[model samples]
Target chain A: MEPPRALLFDVFGTCVDWRSSIIREGEALGRRLGLGTVDWAAVADAWRALYQPQMETVRSGARPWVTLDVLHREALDRVLADAGLQGVPESDRADFTLAWHRLDPWPDTVAGLHRLGQRFVVAPNSNGHIALMVNLSKRAGLRWDAILGAELARAYKPQPEVYLRGVEALGLVPSQVMMVAAHNVDLVAAAACGLRTAFVPRPTEHGAGQTTDLRPARPVDVVATDLGDLAGQLGA
Target chain B: MEPPRALLFDVFGTCVDWRSSIIREGEALGRRLGLGTVDWAAVADAWRALYQPQMETVRSGARPWVTLDVLHREALDRVLADAGLQGVPESDRADFTLAWHRLDPWPDTVAGLHRLGQRFVVAPNSNGHIALMVNLSKRAGLRWDAILGAELARAYKPQPEVYLRGVEALGLVPSQVMMVAAHNVDLVAAAACGLRTAFVPRPTEHGAGQTTDLRPARPVDVVATDLGDLAGQLGA
Candidate 1:
């Protein structure tokens, strides 16, 4: 088979440890806001849990087209209130919302991506909108050749349109691009769309709370330990 | 006034020295094809002359949305035949068409963009489609934060939607995004859409046949000698 000309990555849990970053930031903000004994990690998880359902609302037409940032803000507000944090200032709320913009990259992310990018057109094909992903890249030093998102397709991920739209944007057939992700479901979705797939297991993506995706979940083209390992496997 | 948070640059004349690069490439290709006495520079100029008119065809609804690469290829074919070039094989035509993908940047472009990229989000707001711009960035060493193009808006540049679409893609307000270009008319259209504007004169963009845009034709927020000067002026 022809070597992949492009590598499309799943951004959130794959390249960046969003759960830990969000929890750490949330805990710090919670303490400053005088919230005692708050389960910031749990709150972070809960906020993330809302992600799919929230996008589903838009997907199902219960909501109009809203960016991931907006969805994140709405979810944060609800989660903060439910966690019993009250009367937070609007500026603080805005700051909390902007936390998504400052996500930290996984330990091997930058170096691995840099290596891989030397050979391939590497980019993020994520549920995150282009703006959010671009800001996150700048903040976290994630070197992406381009920022692509479901927002470009007006649809969320796990949908064929997302993968197809990304390939179309790159001016390549789906087969010419490879989708690399820690999530088996994402890789499966991409494989279904006729793109090459690589699974890089992030066993601790949920930080000891992880249960699913402990191993290669399907017949993906490649299975690596991490981004660095994936880079090596790809001969980058 | 609040400083512009993002700078959107026009690519062809403003960033890459397309005229000279195309002329050089065409001349080299002409020589390789044994087309002696062929005026490649004139052919290049003639091809470029077809740019605005072709885009105008699309803009005027006489043609559909065609990428700059496709338009360039079409123009190259016409100009080659009109210039009395002979024995240009089909394979050579494909090679000549790919020349646009390998444009050389002006001397200061890489350094200027590197410096400016340190301060603000920098991207190309060009008539080139996303794939073309992205490939060009990789080929020409343009350090763009993101690639924005007319393809995303399904329209050509100087159109309000193209300018506003770029701002929206960057997740910035019109006032927070500045359109930087060598052409006064481009800035005029951008300013009319409420975007901030910067002018960097590319006096010889039209080459030895150059006759206009030796300087800013209209008032804009910032005027500079070149990208390097613009970077210094912007404190980048």
Candidate 2:
């Protein structure tokens, strides 16, 4: 089959190396605070653990719509308190939460994106709001044909509206747009919405002992080792 | 005062020389149809003139929300019929309506956006939906830091929600983002929503004999000859 006209990415670990980057930034903040011996990676993992539940409130209509930045900030505060890493100033916490906006892409992301951009429109179908996506794109030099996804739907990923509206925004039917992610769940959701799907496993997204999504847990149209391999497979 | 961190543009006439671009494309289509001696320029103006009233129907709840593409398509059919350019093929008519997507940016647009990209986050806060804006950006090389506007707000410009939500998506207060446009009406509405405004006149946007918005009709934070001047004045 021919390739889709646009590729929408589930960005956190699919495009950007969120785990290591967040840990590195968290550790630096811990060092500056003299909060010795903090498990920065663990903090990063724990903080991400809160992502789904926090978004659930909004999805369930228990809360007004809030962007991922707000979700991340609130999650960080609670995670820090629970981990007994309190006393980090609100200003520092705010800055630390912004680490999501400064993630480093996998070494292959930039070059692969450049190649793929020649063929298809590339954008982050991220839960990250437009601002976070903008900052991340600017910092990482990931040239997107457009910025799109969740904020436009006023909902989080896996919501039908998010994937539906994502394809709609591209002025294409879902079948003409592919949702590429490192996670099977995201692919599952997108496929259910009638979009094409690709899974590029980020085995170490949660570090060396990562259990989930070590491989494509379910069927997808394309499965590659990394974005570079994906680009090659897609003929970009 | 410090320049805003983000600049949201009005796309139709501000960044793109839509009149010339549309006229050129329309005349080509006209010739293809063997409809000799058609005044394509007037058709372009008449089509654009329908933009406000079309959007106003949605604004006033006279119709359900329809995207700019749909609105343009509807308006194009009416404009063609009125001009006696009837019975155009469905596919050809659809492609013609997308002339907005193929608009040529003003000569200064690419260079000025590049300059401004060094400092402020640049985006098109246009009534144009994400796809049209995305196509325009790729075709014209207008680098946008983000895309936010009518589609997200479910309304067209001049609606306070458009400006308010546009700013909110950037995670900034309205005052921290400038709305740059060639139309005084746009700046007036943006200002009413607390956004900083810049007026850059495109006196020839409606073709020769156009008289409105020859100068700033309302006080704007900056008035520049074009985007390049705006970039220079804003120190980007």
Candidate 3:
């Protein structure tokens, strides 16, 4: 098989451990708000659990497509209420909502990306809006050549359109690009569209209760321990 | 005055010394093709002289919007003929056409942008297409936050819609953006649409034959020696 000319990454749980970051940030916000002891980790897990169903609502045409920022905001409001954090001021809520933009990268992500970037065009194909992704990259030092977001497509991933649109924007054929992800579903979707796929397992992405994706579900171009290993495997 | 949250720069004369690079490259190519003792610098100047009128063709609706890549090709063809160069293969012409993608950045540009990027979002708002700009940035070490180009707007710069489209894509208000250029016309056009402006003197941009933009023609928010000075003036 021809080596991929570009690598499009799935950002959230794949590049960064969003669940733990969100829980930590939530715990701090909870303490500051005098909300008393709460299961911040559980809240983070629950909020992530809602992510798919919420997107499915839009994907299934039950609701209009909204940017991940808006989807995340809506999820935050609902989860806050469910967690019994009532009467939160709008300003405080806004702060909490932006926590997604500040998630720290996984240990191997930065150096690994820089190494891979030396060989290929590397970028995030995330549900995050362009502004959100740009800010996240700056804050986290993701070292992306460009940020490709759902906002540009007005559609979220695992949708074929997102992958196709991103490759087109890069002036690359889908076959010349690889989709790198921790999630099998995202890789599968991209593969179906003729993009090469690389899977790096992130078993704890969903936190302590995480059960699946301890390893890649299928044979992919390069399955490795982490992004650094992936970079090595790709000869980058 | 409110500080612009983003700065969009003009690329050719503003960021890179395209004329000298092209002239040097052309001279080398001329020698390889046995076209000895040719005045390649004159050819470079003649090619650059076609820039504005070529873009003007698009701006004035005499031609549909074409990327700087296409315009470069047209200009190269005209200049090659004018210089009476013989037996230039199609492949050689294609390679020559890509010279725009390989132009070297000004000495201060990379470091200056690295400094300014620590504060304000910076990007190129160029007549080049996104692919051309992206490749050029990678090749030239230009540190743009995003690549905004005429292809995205389907119009050339100095067009209000082109300026406004960049603002909207950035999720910024017009006032929150600045146009930085070596040309007074570009800054004035951007200012007319309520964006802030900065002028950087590139008196040698057109070589010793330079006759315009010795300094800013109008009151711009900041004037500086080069990008490094601009970064210093912006307190980055």
- Each prediction's Cα RMSD? 1.6, 1.6, 2.6
Q: Lowest-scoring 10 consecutive residues by lDDT in candidate 1 chain B?
A: B208-217
Q: For candidate 2, lDDT tens digit of each residue in B1-236?
A: 97798999999899999889989999889788888888888898899899899999999999988888899999999999999878789988989989889999989889988998888988889999899999889888888878888888888889999999888888899889999999999999999999999999998888788888899987899999998899899998
Report the alpha-carbon TM-score of model 2 versus the true structure: 0.96
* Stretches > 4 Å off in candidate 3: A56-65, B1-3, B56-66, B81-86
What local lDDT does model 1 show for residue B62?
95
> What TM-score between 0 and 1 does chain B of candidate 1 receive?
0.96
Give the per-residue lDDT of model 1 (tens digit) for A1-236. Answer: 67899999999889998888988888888789877788878888899999999999987878787898899889888987897776778888888888888889888999999899888999899998878887998888887777776877888888889999899888899999999999988999999999999998887878796898888778999998888898898898
Alpha carbon deviation, residue B151, candidate 2 (Å) = 0.6
Q: Would you list the C-alpha lDDT of every candidate in the order shown?
A: 0.86, 0.90, 0.84
Model 2 chain B worst lDDT window (10 residues): B143-152
lDDT of 1 by residue, B139-179 (tens): 87888778886977899988889999889988889999999
Candidate 1: TM-score?
A: 0.96
Candidate 1 wrongly placed segments (more than 4 Å): none
User: Model 2 segments beyond 4 Å from truth?
Assistant: none
Worst lDDT 10-window in candidate 1 chain A: A143-152
Per residue, candidate 2 scores C-alpha lDDT tens digits across A1-236 of: 97899999999999999999999898889788889898888899999999999999999999988888889999999999989978899899999999999999999899988888877888889999888999898889898888788888888888899999888888999999999999988999999999999999988888897788977777889998888888899998
